[model samples]
Target: MTDLDFYARAVVDGTVMGLGQDSLPEDWEDRLGVNYVDDVRKGLMRRDFGLVEVSFQRVRGIWRCFGVGIQVHRLDRGVEAVVPAPVRAEFGEFGSPVGFAGVDAAVARMGGRLESANDGGSTYHDQFLSASTNARVHVVAQVDDPGVGGTSVGDVWSIHLSWRKNQDS
Candidate 1:
């Protein structure tokens, strides 16, 4: 890897390591999945977002980490980089929104689904990376919010993440 790439990898590693070790989702191993190939992909190109700040929103319940597939890549993260996340959703059209009791009926008919989310924004910065530099990083956070009022749901609240090395330390 090039020097720039090496430094970028460090940042990506830092971010993933940080998230895994963060109080919010300390047990990432039990929550998410990872592999050797994807780990490299999770450390791809990364830079910074000038002026702007990173926002990893606060959430409830246990945070889990699942394996990131090939289609979705996780970009790297840098001191001055803003990595936008690209996610896919598999949400099917449920006939109607009935009472909480109807959720089971709906799932029994339409079945579960996944969908992709918006991956937008173009920004950069130069902090720990260097002086006056620009780096671009794109990541994917797969956060699954199990619909409320589900009794059997093992994990009431959780999120799944996928994308370019996208960026898993």
Candidate 2:
């Protein structure tokens, strides 16, 4: 297999994107010799979370699957809607900002059919699976920040990945 045959898969976890850790993992500051800071944006983390990007091998006959968490905050009168119960359980939680204009709703929104619990908030997710390793996918997350600047919402997205098998060039 040529160098290009090796594919890279990234899974972003956080409160907004819910890439995984609210606080980064111990060994994750830098791994696989890739610069994460460049793939992730911080200023946006104060509001949106779970945004992860990476560069890996591109191969043939490989299938890749990834997941990310998304969080949305809406005030009692703000624009973003609430996330239902079932959605929260799977995605994460629904929350609000303290001393802010609205309520808090956090959900595990992903890409696929959802088993909804209630009605009131906006819940969503997106997914793409490729049978070929040479394929790269783009995942978009939508999060609402009811409170900006001060409260932070402390939203952030981290990324991780798992891969196996080598392909030919």
Candidate 3:
């Protein structure tokens, strides 16, 4: 079985266009690797980027990722205004930021399937199971329309993935 962190990294990197922990905010790490245990012990901890908030949990050798959230910001020198349409289309015809359609495609590409789905107001949550392993990945995507610098940039989608430890690993 693959390690939870390993599988999770694969899923996260895969979904987020090859971004890794190194790409996460420096506040998310420590000498012990991701500092996930401390974050969880201290309650929901977050690593903030000007336009994003990331949370994760890895404790007792298990993995539990909270979700990555992106805030809509107006186009600026450093801020990029983007719609994940092309990215989502590459995965599948998932409509909107809160739709689990793209996630369905992501899981399929990883050789998995949607095991369950839950709707929670502005957020959509789903779980995927690996066919070749016992890993379970949970994903949460939020639909947000935040005004950045007084600009109304509509519906921005932010997503995060959490993975359970593989028993076999």
Candidate 4:
């Protein structure tokens, strides 16, 4: 395997280990598929609860990974409940009586500054950037009550975390 290939594998392996998986997924190789275009490399992996994507580009005469991202989907309800506490601790807690206030407070405590928030008709999206790692974590929630103009953390459908190398670090 090339260096980029190794890096991509490492990302998947690390994610699996970090998330406390017993072993690499049976279809790990298939999930951690790789594709190439020109000189860029894209790696994708899917987990029971989410997906992981990593991208690398040739820079300064060397292959450099640009970003790594984790996207949790809402294909199944109660998915958020299964998120490991240790992982949640990494980003701070969304808190009990989960709601927008808790999520906002969690981001602040995690050193993530609000970057943007938008309403997408049925869903509300909020993006936060962590000062420590320069990574971004976005939360998407179902609009429970438009009249209230707020989203409940319990209504959160998905959460995505992304790490980009030196874009702002």
Candidate 5:
């Protein structure tokens, strides 16, 4: 399977490496198959792991991971350069060549369900709930204006898996 497929399944299974944990695994880089750069600014810790970016915050003197973002499309030239080849290859639709249909099938296969969807003129958004993790899985895609008529959901921009609740500080 492609890296995108692997990571997407991980999100649904609630087994994403180093996710929602107080500390990263000793071999996190090797497990994730990418080197990461850590950024600690504005009291938040962000780790850019090429294909996956994780966000952490300090709680009770411990660094706790709360969210993860996966890169799908080549939105930013700089970030696009770092996205792995496997991920880039799976960049169409809902981060798959088959688009939303493929994502729906995969999610169902993994015991997840689509919670909601929105077509925001130039962008499309899909939210999913993982059965295992109860985490929120969000997908954002660019909407292509064909100019002839109605727009179409284009390539996926990004996917985010977050454990944070709306009321969380």
Candidate 6:
């Protein structure tokens, strides 16, 4: 499958490069060879993999990845400049771009159900519950106007795939 397809499926399946694993290995970052930009001691660590960003939280003294945020459209030129050229090129090579429509379809196909949505003037947000993994899925879109009935319809700005919150975490 194409990398884009893998990512889209990850959103529906609630697993992005092992982000939603029940228990992440202590050397996950080392194994992935991805360096985190933030300090792990802060309890929250962020790793930017160009097209996607993964976050890990320390739970019970173990580092557990909680979420992944994928960037779809490059809206900010200034921010884009900061990303390495090779990293930026990965997006172009990742296959056809997918927006909310594509992701929504994938969600339906994967048996995920929409939980909530919000229209925030220029932006739209949606929350979903993945049937397979029981994870939380979030989609953000950049829209010219609010979608009818609070539906998120626009070029997908970002996708946040995360594990369901645990009570003791």
Cα TM-score per model = 0.16, 0.21, 0.33, 0.36, 0.62, 0.58
Error of 4 at 24 (Å): 9.6
Of the candidates numbered 1 and 3, which has the greater TM-score value?
Answer: 3
Best by lDDT: 5
> Which residue runs of candidate 4 sit more than 4 Å off their true CA positions?
1-43, 49-76, 79-81, 84-97, 117-124, 131-134, 139-156, 164-169
lDDT of 2 at 55: 23
Off by over 4 Å in 6: 22-32, 39-41, 74-92, 95-97, 111-116, 119-153, 164-169
Query: Model 4: how far is 54 from its true place, Å?
Result: 8.9
Say which candidate scores most in TM-score.
Answer: 5
Residues 20-130, model 6: lDDT tens digits: 554464444543445335545456766665555667777886667777666554333333433334333433334323455666675666666545445343334555555
10 residues in a row with least lDDT, candidate 3: 72-81
* Candidate 2 C-alpha lDDT tens digits along 1-169: 2100111212111122222222232222332122233332322212121222322222342222122222222322231233332233443433333211111111112221112222323232222333322121222234355333223422222112334224442
Deviation in angstroms for 9 in model 1?
2.7
Instruction: Residues 1-169, candidate 1: write the lDDT tens digits.
Output: 2222222322333233234222232233222222111111222311112211122222233223322111111122232122222111112221111121232233223332222222333121111111111122222122244332332222111122222222233
Q: What is the lDDT of residue 21 in candidate 6?
A: 52
**lDDT of model number 6:** 0.53
Model 4 weakest 10-residue run by lDDT: 1-10
State the C-alpha lDDT per candidate. Answer: 0.23, 0.25, 0.37, 0.37, 0.54, 0.53
RMSD for each of the candidates: 20.1, 17.2, 10.5, 11.5, 5.8, 6.2
Q: Candidate 1, residue 67: CA error in Å?
A: 17
2 versus 3: better TM-score goes to? 3
Model 2 alpha-carbon drift over 4 Å, by segment: 1-62, 66-85, 89-93, 98-169
Query: By TM-score, how accurate is candidate 5?
Result: 0.62
Which candidate order results from sorting by TM-score in descending order? 5, 6, 4, 3, 2, 1
Candidate 5, residue 18: Cα displacement in angstroms equals 6.7
Better of 3 and 5 by lDDT: 5
TM-score of 6: 0.58
